[model samples]
Target chain A: MAGNVIEINNLTKRYGKHRGVEGVSFTVKEGDIFGFLGPNGAGKSTTIRSMLGFLGYEGEIKILGSDARSGHEKLMKNIGYMPSEAMFYPSMKVSEVIKLAADVRGTDCADEAGKLCERLKVDTSRSINELSLGNRKKVSIVCAMQHKPALFVFDEPTSGLDPLMQNTFFELIEEYVKQGTTCLLSTHVLSEVKNYCKNVAIMKEGKLISCGSVDELTHTNSKRVIVTADGKKSDYLYKGDMNSLIADLSGKNITQLDITDPSIEEIFMGYYEA
Target chain B: MITLFKHEFKQNLKSLLIWSISVGTLGLMCVLLYQSMTEDMQALSDSFSNMGAFSDAFGMSTLGIGTLKGYFATEVGAVHGIGSGMFAAIMATSLLSKEEDGHTGEFLYSLPVSITKVVAVKIAACITGLILFSVITGIFYISGVAYLGENFETDLFLKYMISVLLMNIEIACICVAFSAFVKKNMIGAGLGIALLFYFSDLICRISPDLKDYIVYGPYSLANATEIFVGNEIAASAYIISAVLIIAAVVTAFVKYTRKDLAS
Candidate 1:
């Protein structure tokens, strides 16, 4: 049986009148790709920040079976974090930047970095300022993965990446998971979560509204109904029996009717609205 | 910590070079011009000394402009003093705040190193940069004096340079303290602080009533006229500078350690 790699309990952070996160609690098992789902301001980053010991919070957080804050420096040696927007000194080349991070970690990641750079198509000689957004993200990916950490925390890691690069990124992540790595992935793309993540926790307005296995959350019988009748179309999520839905719509001058299962995004939106 | 220090020092090395070279060259040129302006300076010195407060404010009366030492005091001293102060201020002010303002803290603070350690290393780097600036600028001034073959008191010049370095460290520490409290890069504020102390020092010199309070500002300790004429800087000025440096460093460390870094 796999043990929990990350356990956060009753985590709350507040600044002045602004609320960062409230009563957030969740756990990620070892070797699991845990999807953290939320909108732009839904406290995903705040939780990640607190877990990384970047911000002080009221509650308990344990990473790799040690207190997160007390053992931050030790735990960080085994954690790789890729921030939402990758930024580096404009004058430094990508290779220099990678070398600095490796030096900070006190490890020589040259061979792994070389492989990742080649796979990601990142130019090592180009200065950071000269690289495009996607290329910078690729560099960030290399930095995060080159060390082969036990846990990976990536926030919106694929926003600027193209489809091909995104695929390569996930493939790399999957390979790491195969080697007994855990990942806490925060993203807005629900399709990625459905495709790659086994478990998920959904947040809304600084609160975790739903959390469970991906199959449990998306296994509901609710289907999206799009009805075009009387020269007008009506679209909404329907949870009633299909016969009842058809009987109710039979009296209308229905030109077209389409019913399909709701994707994880729609299911998660239901929680947000609720 | 060493890696961070090296990176930070390299990052600001260009700015350091530009500032030190420009100010050092200016100081050297001022020293070289003394010989060419000897006759004109002699003619102006007598009248200048009789100008009362105007001469006193600029040290023309106390340190006469006819001699090389006095000329250097009244000219190169002011240039180097203001230049070094501004350079130190500008460099230290944005040293820490730019990390937050530019969103680089997200990268730095995420590393295994503690925030306290990072802050300490950065302050050390700032002080090291100031030391190098002093050394480079001092070499330029010494070369100028040596090349001219003029009779000058090396002791007084060294004392003045040491005091200037202390004054710069004082300003840099204060700005570093301010950097911890601010989220944006405050280069303008840093420059303003250097100018404010300078003009205040000038005002104190011009006004006899304000003379007793000269120790309140950093410029008093580095005053060219005072140092070149072998006048002792008030003991209270040194005490105050020591206190300010300690207090500012303590404030920066405490504030930054607990700060919720802006993302």
Candidate 2:
């Protein structure tokens, strides 16, 4: 249990008993793309902030086999963080911001910065204030990934990205994983997590209500089935299955059914509904 | 910490330039005025008197308008005192609190540097700024003294000048400490300067009997004349001021290292 790259034990952060986060625990193995899945305000950001040593809390966290509180700076040097809401000076250019970040972090990654910029198709010449949300996200992503840190802590890194750019991000993540880097991805997008993460932890009401691999969590949950009958009538659903909600559309509806597994979103919803 | 200091210093070079120009130009202008008026001592004295007690309080009398201790006291308590102190205050406040206001602190917290390092480096930068004001103004003082008379005691002026330098550093440290607690640059600078100048007068108005107790005050430091005249500089006043500054800086460092930056 202790053989993990990141180990959080009994972490509790309370703001006048408002429960910023409470008694949350988790472990991330080396090279594990761990997904911290939760909706907004479900303590995802709180957990990440605490782990980064930005906040004092009543818990012990370790990063790369070192205590997060006592060994924060040394451990964090190996991490790349992309905050959910990225804020940069309006007057600074993207290139300028990236350079400043690298300077402060004691990293020299001009080549990596350039390569990431080129791959993401980001225009680094524009001022941050003049950038669109998606482009701003691109700047943040570039800043986070430029140095190829050992651990990548992303907070909604893909929220504003287009589908094409999202695919690019996934490619980058995959590339990084191949290089033996770990990722602790925090996001509400079940589909993205399901596709890319090796292990997933789900949170609800400031607690980890359910967590595990996609297959393990959803094995007994409801399966979705879609059937294509004939070209003339394509709508179809089984009418007699008590475990399923069936709908048979008339006029160009399917005449038969094709059974498929329920998506990660449905499984996540099921945890709350149950 | 050195890296942090360098980063802060580079970031503030422009502001330093502006302050430098202001001080340089002001010193140059005053020298020019002194040059034009040295022949007419009565006219100079009348002009200096007309400039008001506040101007006298600022050390404008150091130009030898009447060649009196009152003029030197005016210079010690007023111009160089307030001007240098305020400059140090601005520099220190801006260095510590701008990160929070710009939301840059959020991003920076994620980096590998500890907040302790950040605070230490920033304090060093504040001290550097303090020295800049003091050193640059020392240059002005020497040049102005040279303009006044060839026989002025350069050694005494230099010795007295260290007290003023230390006075500026004391003010800078207090402002930086205030900035760390408040986490707002403008408000921290405003309050720090106002408190430094205001409390000095407030204690004076309240009566000399209460002077020693207002240890949390920097107006005592502003009393550079008394300190430079080889007096003890009121040991309790300076000690109290030192204690307040140390407390602020320590608290800021502790808070910065542990404060949750999510917001």
Best by lDDT: 1
When candidate 1 is compared with the true two-chain complex, its DockQ is 0.66
Task: Please give the lDDT score at residue A146 for candidate 1.
Answer: 87
Best by DockQ: 1
- Tens-digit lDDT track for model 2 on B1-263? 55566767776767766775577556545554554555675666667656544333433433444442333444433556666666777777666678877777767677778878888877877677667766776676566656666454445456556666666676677666667665556855554685556556554534546544545566665454443344455677667777877776777787666655535
lDDT of 1 by residue, B1-263 (tens): 88989988998899999999999999999998889999799888899899998899888888889999899898999899999999999999998898988888877876778888888989999999999999999999989999999899999999999999999999999999999999999999999988998899889989999998888888877988889998899999999989999999999999988788788
| Per-residue lDDT of candidate 2, residues A1-274 (tens digit) | 4258888888888877598888898888888899898878889888888888877889889988888888888877888898877777667789888887788777798999999999999888888989887998888888889888999999989878999999999899899989989999999988887899878888877887776776687666355656565554333223245443443334445667666666667767776545
What range of 10 consecutive residues in model 2 chain A has the weakest lDDT sum? A233-242
Candidate 2 segments exceeding 4 Å error: A1-3, A89-93, A103-107, A122-133, A223-262, A272-274, B35-65, B68-77, B140-153, B186-189, B192-206, B211-216, B222-232, B235-238
TM-scores of all candidate predictions against the true structure? 0.96, 0.82
- CAPRI quality band, candidate 1: medium
DockQ of each: 0.66, 0.52
Q: Candidate 2, which CAPRI tier?
A: medium
Superposing all C-alpha atoms, what RMSD in Å does each candidate have to the true structure? 1.9, 5.0
Overall lDDT per candidate, in order of appearance: 0.91, 0.71
lDDT per residue (tens digit) for residues A165-267 in model 1: 9999999999999999999999989999999999999999999998999999888889999999889999999997989998999899999899999877898
